[model samples]
Target: MTRPSNDSLNAAWDLIDHSQLILVVMHTNPDGDALGSGIALTLGLRQQGKEAHLVCPQPTPLIYEFLNPGDIVEPEAPAGVPDLAVVVDCDRADRVGALQGLVNQARRVLVVDHHPPTSDFGDVRLSHDGYAATAEVVHYLLAHRSVPVTGRMAEALMTGLITDTGGFRFSNTRPETLEMAASLARAGASVADISRRVYDSRTLAGLKLLARALASLQSSPAGTVAWARLSADDFAETGAAPEDTEGFVNVVHSLRGADVAALLREEQPGVVRISLRSRGAAVVSQAAEALGGGGHALAAACVLEASLDDAEERLLQELRKWTAF
Candidate 1:
């Protein structure tokens, strides 16, 4: 909960300006927020006369492609790594997958994130839980340095801010959040268009994934937690890509009497991915970090080295102990 000092911001600005090449990385299986923030920062860094590129461990989310500049992310680092590496929207280096070495190889690593961190991975970290999305933090960084916004930057940043904030419906939506969104809109970001692309468009495979998840929904006796699971075989059955289940967990959370909702997915043979959402500040990141994962307080996630069934059992055990308080 420490406020970032002026010295840290100034140091980040200096590093960003002096670096010849800057490489930006986001977490694996990126969502709208991750893509939006990374692309906006890419634009911001380029505008400052620095060469910037985006690298992710996996392919860009289909929903995000429309908002971002076409094919902005390079799945592999081209040629050599950059002089400076920056991670956006993610807290830990492990989440960057193969890109972790790129971060370690960099002379300077600047992390701009909003997620609650279990480790101090950044040489200069500007983290604020008050912000709804990482794009909001990037917006502040641009404003602090008096950087002008282009329509591309505005569109990207606005997509992140609106989607992560649930169209400003979540409780984290504050006056400053709205102010940031208004600024992006004034700079030529279209709210209606962003909504249409992000929410209105969905593939048949995605709907099948949703149906499978909903069929697996189970609730606790106290109605405190509602959970669903999707195994690897289910993905094969539905022909659903990982990105198809982007916000499927939120559907379980929307149920009546549910204070918390969780989704467990089997990414591969042995990797199980879990997403947790709480109606209040239950601090799921602590639990996630304990299981070698990390995220925000209200919405945290972890990947367990176990089957989806085993991971669910372990996660529910932790939740039972936490809710006991």
Candidate 2:
């Protein structure tokens, strides 16, 4: 695995040493990479006798409740202003949602992420898109600092690695990723248990939601683009929260002729969440960036402030502009 630069690693450690109270914030929706990095950092800092608090804009997804990191709190600012804020797995500060205010209160901001930065907000930005997951970067940082990776920390980091790589099946997975997984396993991370809880176990309601989403699947005329929609009604009927629809977008990529896939979810009345995926050289991040969202080349997302139908039409227009087929 490529190592983090010594300058960046030393600078981050210096900031941590000079700070007493630290705030760690993840993105609004709080995916596995986001949670894994934030929680692991929180635990690591606290282990060093520093006061570290983890903030998530939304509640932890039911599937990830196995993490049970007690330090996670709502977006509200803590008792005292934090000396340092660590933003993980988020490309932009605004992605922290309401917690941006709390982060702004910190004296210094350190951004450790794997996505391309949309803006220069953090005081110290340690971003490397080459890494498969932000947790890998975090693991590197901790290892360099000589922080012992506890069993819990290993599990959390492994969760981020597995989830971000689609269980090591995505194109981003590399030899280094597997190497990290093997090290984490040796440190007592249960690959089987974490995989089962994250990918295998699903609530009955989630399954119903998945069925409804699949039922709405559609393809473009040339069959190069496949898409699906999940309406607010579907969520209400199935009694599934938005988090339960995590991997539903991958279903579109299963189609034989599909080079691009999208999943549009209408979680609120005038708001649509768009998740895009592409194969080979097709770049879905470009489409997401056009819509004021960003992610990796193959997987990206955006939010549209329109009705589901209008969002669908707009996204289709955008996808057609880049899709080869």
Candidate 3:
């Protein structure tokens, strides 16, 4: 990943300066980074008297309900075409899901993300490669534009920072990332509160789902690779929503001597979603891309319209290419 070019950065602000009504959107799953960056940017734009609205096709995950990403992320797209639409977190516009229709009608589109830019989606891209999270890039852009950071904005940005960095425990967490987090804390984001809700909080349904996932865990012959599966039945039986499966992959990754891990869930009757994690020689993003998905090097995801066994096999095959031992 590379940093945003000065030309693209200038074009992004120029597009904003020339527009009035702006539509903000994130990827379909609406993770902490998506919700936080979208909310913070929406709030900041509104503070400057722009008619900015952040909307998503999917509801905010239960774990991120504290940020109230749903408060402004209505399902209804704006009736008319927006002067500019900003896509956050995701590199491609298609990842916006049902909201793609709304983005298609916008006069201009700007992307704010940290993913490896694989597609030409936005008219002006502020995608940076080195940041720990998209929220970090958003913060840098906001400061570059001289926007005043509000308490609410700070809170949302912190959510993105903490969650994506795993509370600053991941390899991507740098000194500068911590400094930005401190700045956000000074603006009002509570580290303890965000951590408690995101990492510590658990629902009965989620716990039940975790048990089923653990029961289904499997490993490769070498024991360096691990995976888990949950069918639609498991989710329905446990009364667990899709978002409840969020961190379950980490449990698989924690398996002793595992270099790579995956969690596959049947999102629908034939549609399976897989999340990948790696901490060794594997770069899961390549596997994700081959499976028609994309993400960071350590974390990536993909979707497959196949049976649980088939999807599991596909992912295992991908992992086998990297984790031979």
Tell me, by lDDT, which candidate is best: 2
Question: Per-residue lDDT of 1-325 in model 2, one digit per residue for the tens?
Answer: 3768999999999999999999999988788888888888889999888999887756788788888854455555579989999999988888888888888999999999998667888988888888999999999889888899999889899999989998999888878889999999999998899999999887899999999988999988888889999999999999998888888888778888898999999989889999998876589999998987788888999999999999999998898888864
Worst 10 contiguous positions by lDDT, candidate 3: 1-10
Candidate 3: tens digits of C-alpha lDDT, residues 209-253: 999999998888898888899999999999998888878998898
User: What order do candidates take by TM-score, descending?
Assistant: 2, 3, 1
CA lDDT of each prediction against the hidden true structure: 0.83, 0.88, 0.87
Count: clashes, candidate 2: 0
lDDT of 1 by residue, 204-307 (tens): 98898899999999998887789999999999999999888877888989989777788999999789999988778366766676777767777888889997
Q: Judge candidate 3 at residue 189 and give its lDDT.
A: 89
Clash tally for model 1: 0
Candidate 3 segments exceeding 4 Å error: 1-7
Off by over 4 Å in 2: 71-75
Model 1 ranges off by over 4 Å = 1-6, 69-71, 78-81
